[model samples]
Target: MPRWFNTAGPCRADHHYMLPALRRLPEVLPLIGQESYFVLHAPRQVGKTTALRALAEELTASGRYAALHVSCEEGEAAGDDFAEAQRAILSRIRRSAEIYLPAELHPPPFPPSPDISLLGTALAAWARVCPRPLVLFFDEIDALRGQSLLNVLRQLRSGYSDRPTAFPASVVLCGLRDVRDYKVTTDSRGHLGTSSPFNIKVESLTLRNFTRDEVEELYQQHTHDTGQVFLPEAIDRAFYWTQGQPWLVNALARQMVEKLVPDRGQALTAAHVDAAKEILLRRQDTHLDSLAERLREPRVRRILEPLLAGLALGEVPADDLRFVQDLGLVRLAPAGGLEVANPLYREVIPRVLANTAFASLPPQSITWLRADGRLDTERLMEAFLAFWRQHGQPLLGTAPYHEIAPHLVLMAFLHRVANGGGTLEREYAIGTGRMDLCLRHGPDTLALELKVWRDGEKDPLEDGLVQLDGYLAGLGLDSGWLVIFDRRTGQPPIAERTRAVAATTSTGRRVTVVRA
Candidate 1:
């Protein structure tokens, strides 16, 4: 049977076209040799479990250690009941060992005890009886929280010195966060603290997404199995869109092959990749949906709100920025600062946030279309001005992030305009102080830049025009719009303040300046 792309669970070599799992994790074996306890973390679906499981199998096969991968996810339901969580975790480990380890390496039965502190004693006994030095990978360790989470970490720390004989020689705690970020309550009274309970960790390692070459190599595995091929442009576009995110890379290929084009004789192209991307964005599959759920989190919002508004992140904690990066939602920009992790995420964030406002917008006709079905920029601008006059105030309240309220309202209106067989794209970055929009319909392309004029700041028209000029140059256009939203106190009503005027940029680009 031919192997295919995998989007769910751990990738099996016999059934999935996967990169060499162990090869991707180069630090695990060396750490184990040093008898080091460490943390392995990454965003969800980035293949942490698959790599750890494969490493455990390889280690066991080498006849030097009894290695096992056990999940603490089941214990999550036990909540703060450390005793119940301990039982569930031990049961999970027993089941996993029976399936993955040789009979002699299987841990002996746990002592029947209701005391929560006995977890360390049970593990110490297992290590003493096991035929070889034991190695344990605790997958999804962060799934435990509160007292349950604290108890587990404390138990492990209590057994730290007993390793190599009375306890596992090396233990790997695998989860979505580094140990320092783990939130635990100190007492039953519910006082919270951000301290590492598992302070014995030698290092914290993160699993990185595949590189462009790795993505190409993964796709070539499918070409080797079947006669189908992904064109070079398609591969490049896929990498650019996803930045080699593991699940996204696989999902795009799976979508193209299984849903878009199934015939082996049909070669995949960049257009197919684009269509697949649209489908995924519209469908909001489990992975993207999970990411969207993070938007509601306070820490996530602290960094993302200003990001979408194109403002400098003000006084955000360094750990907060690092947390978002670890979650794979953003990355350090090459120029400086942080940005949405990839083009795909950059597209998904605003669309997801604007979805509710888009639904609330009244039905709009395609009156801005010319006789030849091309989009008319002037007519579209007039229509948007009218829309802003009528509904922008009410719609702005629906946005979850107040810093980007105007931006979201405008995006909602544009979404409605582009609903009729047109495409809209957006670009913003930290400290840009503007949001750039591109609308493509048939042969017409409209470039729009949005800026907010606050009370303390001077007029934004000059800077907006200059920025829009550079943006237009990049798009090979000679003209565009610089929209200045007057948000200063004591300003006239939006209807009274809104109007458009013709202006020229310093770079000699003709710009229609819209003050609204």
Candidate 2:
């Protein structure tokens, strides 16, 4: 069968182009061999289940152990009902064992036990009767909630002593988060807080996104299969854009080959890769939508708001930071601070944050273009000034994120300007004190910097000019716009203050400074 990129569930070798699963997280096998209990965590759809399942099959096939993969997701429906959750989980284990194991290695029936301790007793019973040592990969273990999650972790810890004989030799809890972040809401017990319930775990590991070389290697599998080639620049573009996010890597290839250019004779180029990225962003596929959904979370908002506006991240909880990282929303940058995990996220965050305002907007009336269909920066500025004078205040209330409301409104308007034919790119970071934008519309490119002049603060016009001067330099442009939103008390209404004027920066750059 022809192999293809996989964007859905676990990658099956028979159906998908894939790298060796165990190779991604090499520590897994050694820990299993040491009879260690650990946590395997990564963002959703990053192949945690696929890797763990492949390892289990490999261990069983090697004749060293009887191993199985199962999910605790089914048990989620039982809520805090520990007995029901255990029954659901144990049933999955028995079913998997029957399918994946030889008859002798299959679990003996789950023994009767109390509701609270059923999982521990059941595992002990399975290990006692099976001829070979058992290894368990508990996927989506975080899905269990409240007392249910706490009970399961306790049960695993309780059975930690009798490895390879009375209990499973190794157990791995797999989920989108480490065990500590599974803050289940229960009536009796408060949050999980910093302490993980599964304290017996020796190590917590994560499946990493593919490296640049692996990205090329995986794409090479496609060329070898279809006799089509992904050009070198195209491969570089993929890595540059996705930064090796597994689902995105596959999804980009899948969308390009499957829809954009179906011909096997054509070589995919950087342009094709760029088109694929735009399509993925505009279509808002399941994986990207799931990520955007997290923007609604308060903890997620707390970190991202300042990051989006290019300001300091105020006092945030450590676990909240870890939680956001675990969700794959952000990562530590090469220069040493946090950044949105990749370019895809950087685009999605603002667009998703401004969704309500974007939807609330009526059709844009300004032509915003020359007769030749090229973007006119002057006309675009005029349109923004006119629109802000009339609709900006009302639209601010439409945005869900209060801290970055001005940022979201402008992004929403820019989304309209760059809607069909071009792209608007955003750049912001901690302590930058402004958000920078690069809008590409046909042959024209416009650079913009946004700053807020809040109450009790001096004007940001000078700071915005300096900041925008640096931004335009990076883009290698001679000119740009510096926008200072006057949000201070006793300022004139937005209609009265919204105006644009040209100014020169310290770097001798022509800047359109808009104080609105």
173-281 in candidate 1: lDDT tens per residue? 9988787666565332232234367788898899988999999999999888888999999999999999999999999999999999999899999989988887888
For each candidate, give its TM-score against the true structure: 0.96, 0.97
- Per TM-score, the best of the predicted structures is 2
lDDT measured at residue 502 in model 2 versus the true structure, 0 to 100: 90
Q: How many residue pairs clash in each candidate?
A: 0, 0
**In model 1, which runs have C-alpha deviations exceeding 4 angstroms?**
185-195
| Residue 97 displacement (Å), model 2 | 1.4
Candidate 2 lDDT for residue 366: 57
Q: Report the CA-based lDDT of candidate 2 relative to the real structure.
A: 0.87
Instruction: Tell me the spans in candidate 2 whose CA falls farther than 4 Å from its real position.
Output: 186-190
